[model samples]
Target: MFPADFAYVRARTLDEALDLLDEAHAADQEAKLIAGGQSLLPMMKLRLAAPQVLIDIADLPELRRGGWMSSVVGGSFGGSIGALSTYRQLGRDALLNGGVIRGRNENVAPHRAEGVPAITDVLTVLADPQVRARGTIGGAVAHGDPASDLPAVLLALNAVLTIASRKGRHPESHLGPYTPRRTRKEPLNIGKREIALDDFLQGIYTTDLADDEIITHIRISHQGGTASAYEKFPHPASHLPLAGVAVVLTYKGGRLTDSNGHVTDLADGSLASAAIAVTGISPRPYRARAAEALLKDAFPTQETLAAAAAQVTTESPGSANRVSLLGDQHASADYRAHLAEVLTRRALAKAIARGGRSL
Candidate 1:
């Protein structure tokens, strides 16, 4: 099947893309932005999305750059990836794939970010090589697919988004207007703000993106002593996760004696903070806060991990039998919940090992 007839317009600049979107909204015409066209094109061909106009921003230079910068004075390490950055670029980037440098300085202290392993793990099995080459991170995020691999990882990292638009150019965003997560220098000439990935994602195939706005970049940050990993059970054919889990553990000052009488250096060798997120088993990917609460500040023992993992089902925390799970031919809701539990345990173990210490 072919996508319905639509007018195609290539945008040479970020402002031009916004202007195109603003015009479409003013005329009450359906317009969609296309970057790599990896997700949208498939939906269009299936008649699930039929925009009357397609705005091409694939060639915009501002949205194609990907790099990271560290702030030692602030005691924070972070970076941003452009909206047009493809999965292939992200997977191959040294800095993104565990090359992150953290802590004060090399002479005084050095550390690795806890967030890199999850990014590397997801990118490795996200899809086939062709899709990784063409699928942009921004597009995958903006598409808001519940089965997406990256969103779960991003959610676990508490990622932030930088958006560009002129105020009042489009109707209010579904999740409301943008709110800055922190203070940052803006472009001045254009309206810009940052949003948390948690707030940015509203539902399946839905997001907080305004019709007249464009996602400029995705920002990620991590404290010095954190460890994170991602695990997924992919479908045999489509390669989408039957259930995917991402876990991030933040450790702080302490030492622990292992079963072998060897001392391990950690923040007490226990989890100071833990974030667990699950995808591909519900209407939306969500942080397993209830499960996280169970593991936070505790030793990641086999018994403790199993107990926390069991709390990762689609059932709402504090509610009995109130659950919503995705049921399809590939897997039933019960099966997905089981997979979520299994993956959570695996992700936790992998993250702990990556932290270079055992509980």
Candidate 2:
């Protein structure tokens, strides 16, 4: 739509999109995928991200739909993601939809449930109503924009990304040797299958999107055995979190669960595992595993929680936006780190409480 002289081609379905791409550029790498146009258009307009050809994958119903997808940890498949789902759509699917922090209609309530706390509390700061209306979860994720909130959440959730091209498919019949436990919801996908989140995501704005290939879906899970939480420092003007953290824990206490299971007693299991994914402070979301190790086995208490909160950051933090609170505003990186630690402690305490505070 800008000064770029790129050709626009719309396909009615995902297969068609892939087929068209396959035909146009069998081995070429100049085609770009267009879904909601929220991420693509902006970059195009600014001339920061322009492609010679815009392949519209919006028409794919598979991308727009939902499906059941999950696999056993240390077993087989991981999860699947339907390509077309937008954040708005996934936000309303009833399964994933709940108390949104800042949704225009019904808010997705942030809750500490099953095993871990919810990040819906941070959603209110993602963006304005108008911007949200147009943004898709897929778009936000595919772009891998460091500043985006949902992207970091997905990372902490350990979300798996699905990609496909007219050229080839993934290990359809066999999941790789490594199968991480389901820490989030099972991904529902259309094209290829779910690859581990680490394997699925290549890098910042750079992925394994093959020639004429695009991401079809993403799947995440926080099944039983995992407790998690999210916290964010938002930008007042855009509601975007300058720093966000998503924590996922694998508790063997037989207490930690997800949106579907029940909480029991930690004494029932004897061991636990937990991890945190962080964003807004780095180029991409990162895990706060080192901080988590400090809380494991340590019975979650107010004091311990506070102590744990102090350890949220071991790495240097990025810059806060040029804004003020009352007169001059600046939530120093140290403050954000402290806040992240606090949220982590709260979420962990909640998890321990659900387990009867029994170490």
Candidate 3:
């Protein structure tokens, strides 16, 4: 399948890309930003998307740089991953793979008990080496594929996205909490807006991104003692998840110590917070708030985990309403619902185990 004829424009810098997008907007011409082209190229070849102009920004340094970034506060760790960071880059990142994070005060670096298992697990099974090498994290998010693995993990982790656009034009509004990081100076500057990943993804192949805007970074914060993991059932041929679940859990309470000062297994603790997100079963990946409500303040027992898993597809916090799920020849609605429940249970168990008895 040959793609429709389109003009290709390679952007020299981030600003140059924004300017090109702005020009396209003014002329009412369709323009799409291309990075790894792992997502767009396929759609273009199938004639699913036929934009008039394609702006290449794969070589922009600002979009390619990423690593452990300082958190907004002390005694915690967070990351500001460049949107264009590929799956391979993320898989090898030390901080994200359970390495010790050195704070500004070098003497008191915090050790992450469990690195973000959700991300690492996704990278391991996302696709073949070829796709993982060329697919950009930002592109995957921006593309908003409903069955994609990473977005569900981001939703569970409560990740934030930094969006950029030309000055004088504000990012879209009424999409959850908005955090703006820019000055009001009257110069030709860039406008940066931060939005929760939950609100950013609206539906299948749809997002809150404006035509003139580009995703700059995906930021995540991990507090001490928090744990997370992802579990999925992928289709045999494509390796895309048939049903995927990501769980992030936080616990409150201290470990028990015996008279000899040895830690015991009798520590009393309760869940402080729980974020459960599921994908591949619905029109869009969604947070399993009903399941979260069930786990909040509860002990992480096998029974409790099972009870919460049963509600992964439930719509309300305390009701029997189920979400409208997607069904196809690959998996029926009933089968997907079943997979969501089973995978959610496994994900919660894995995350709890990662936290150990201390959690």
- Number of the top lDDT candidate: 3
Taken over the whole model, the C-alpha lDDT of each candidate is 0.82, 0.57, 0.83
Tens digits of per-residue lDDT, candidate 3, 1-359, equal 99999999999778889989999889899999998998899899999999999999898776775556444343246768999899998887766776565556767556543467778889887989999999999998899888989999999888888887774344355443354554344134776778888888888898988898889889888776677889999999988889999998888656688899998664356888899999999888899999999999899888999999999999979787898898999999999999999999888888887777532
lDDT tens digits by residue: candidate 2, 210-245: 565567667766564454456666777756566666
Off by over 4 Å in 2: 1-3, 23-29, 69-79, 98-119, 169-193, 224-228, 249-271, 306-311, 315-359
Q: Using lDDT as the measure, what is the rank order of every candidate, best first?
A: 3, 1, 2
lDDT of 1 by residue, 169-270 (tens): 224443355554322433444676677788888788998887877888898876666788999999988898889999988875657898999997665577
Q: How many backbone clashes does candidate 2 have?
A: 33
- Most TM-score-accurate candidate: 3
Of 2 and 3, which scores higher on TM-score? 3
* Candidate 1 clashing pairs, residues 3+ apart or interchain: 252-267, 253-267, 254-268
Comparing candidate 1 with candidate 3, which one achieves the higher lDDT? 3
lDDT of 2: 0.57
User: C-alpha displacement of 306 in model 1, angstroms?
Assistant: 0.3
